[model samples]
Target: MSFDIRPAVPPDAAAACEVLRRSITECCVQDHQNDPDILAAWLGNKHPAMVASWFESPTNYSLVAVRGDDIVGVSLLTGAGKLALCYLLPEAQRQGAGSALLRRLERQAIELGMKTLYLHSTATAEGFFAAHGYRRDGNVRSPYGVETILFWKPLAEGAEPESKRKRFCNCNSA
Candidate 1:
């Protein structure tokens, strides 16, 4: 199936949140182990209302991959160069959606004049980030005692001399 990757909007929050919740619960079982408290605490900030707020936040950039009417994947990037979120439904895994979403965020980062990008990956997603050129930068314990792997990668070379909004961003799509 083909997926259309586009910037997220407030109206997309509820559906996007479903993909987030389902992906985290089913795909990250290795990290959470079906622990109720951990899941609650981990998902506490993921409420649908909160997700909607992110769509309007000036300092954040979010994207979604839609297949027909379903939101199959989602990603969020902060002005501080953090990849705050990246999740895809089980059925969408292994396709190019994740890579496309990530590449778009990296391009947006370069356009925003960011030289470095970082994120904390769940145990289940460590390989995905590593495969995208993110390195092991450090480790941080989540509030639930899960060891999240911190990763960072330098944005591509050539910071064009132009306005931030119009800068030329040549992000790699590999």
Candidate 2:
């Protein structure tokens, strides 16, 4: 199904929050493992009020993907170049909504003069981010018990990536 991506408004908070909550609890089974405690911790702050606050923040750029009158995905980018939140309903996966939302955020970041965009991706989304040119920075365990992969993408054209500047090769390989 096709999705329309647009800037999120205050009225979108409730649906956006629902998307976030359902995406995590249902689609992120690999990360949360259906553990009640972990799910609670992960979703503790994912409420409509908080989502509305994010939409209202001057430093944040938020977007929602809508299929008809229903919101199927949501994303947020911070002024500091963090892709803070990106979520889609379980039914919306693999339908290009996530990719479209991510690409739009990347474009906005570039337009805003951001040099790089970074995000912590769950195991469920690691491959997706990598496929979109994000490089692995490292990993860290979240408070909710999932080990998330740290990924970053350079947004500037012709920028020298750190990986290209340094290389380690075993002498015996030659």
Clashes of 1: 0
Per-candidate count of clashing residue pairs (backbone under 3 Å): 0, 0
- Top model number, TM-score: 2
Native-referenced Cα lDDT, model 2: 0.84
Query: Using lDDT as the measure, which candidate wins?
Result: 2
Where is model 1 more than 4 Å wrong at Cα? 156-174
lDDT of each: 0.81, 0.84
**Tens digit of per-residue lDDT, candidate 2, span 1-174:** 889999999999999989989999998999999999989978888888888888998989999999999999999998767788889999999999999999999999999988887777899999999999999877767766778887889898765344432122111110
| Global Cα lDDT for candidate 1 | 0.81
Q: Score residue 167 of candidate 2 by CA lDDT.
A: 26
User: Residue 88, candidate 1: how far off, in angstroms?
Assistant: 0.5
RMSD (Cα, Å) for all candidates, in order, is: 7.4, 8.4
lDDT, candidate 2, at 144: 64
Over 127-159, each residue of candidate 1 has an lDDT whose tens digit, in order, gives 999999887756777665577887778885742
